[model samples]
Target: MTHNPCLSDMSKRVHRFPLFSITALLHINSTSALMLGRGLTQVTHIKLLLFFQTRHTG
Candidate 1:
């Protein structure tokens, strides 16, 4: 009819660990995706600038 306090605490920790890991993974994925998007935009801008410069020079 009773449970040990230490066991209860350990069970809570075991449950919380997976939730923290999942959120950490999601945060890392979103951060990387944002950086990738910025990189692509920068590459596209640079290419457009190069194309316009070459057209003007020619």
Candidate 2:
């Protein structure tokens, strides 16, 4: 049986949408994770500095 030409193009476009959205989501998640990692590192650095300063003063 011959298929309709209109649905073929439309179906391809529909399939592409999910792939674009998934990659966009990946970019957002990676950026968020990087920011979180940076924040955690800064907090750890501050804690270490404070601990050492207190030890030296005492």
Candidate 3:
């Protein structure tokens, strides 16, 4: 079987930065972090949402 661990980790990292930022801003942990099973765009989009809600909430 081909190993995709590296890719997975890379995905996590890429997902981590923005995700973490959004998480921090939104005050949410990784519980709501979207992975879409494994898609970069989805992950980024989710992170963006997290960021948006985080900053917009008065």
Candidate 1 vs candidate 3: which has greater lDDT? 1
The best candidate by TM-score is 1
Per-prediction TM-score: 0.70, 0.68, 0.34
Model 3 residue runs over 4 Å out of place are 1-38
Residue 27 CA displacement from its true place in model 3, Å: 41
Residue-by-residue lDDT tens digits, candidate 2, 1-58: 8999998999998887888788899999999999999999999999999999999998
Q: At residue 27, give the lDDT of candidate 3.
A: 54
Question: Which stretches of candidate 2 lie above 4 Å from their native place?
Answer: 1-17
Model 2: how far residue 30 lies from native, Å:
0.4
- Order the numbered candidates by TM-score, best leading: 1, 2, 3
Candidate 1 residue lDDT tens string, 2-34:
879999999998887888788899999999999
Candidate 3 per-residue lDDT, tens place, 7-58, comes to 9999888866876576686754343455443577878889999999999995
Q: What ranges in model 1 sit over 4 Å off? A: 1-17
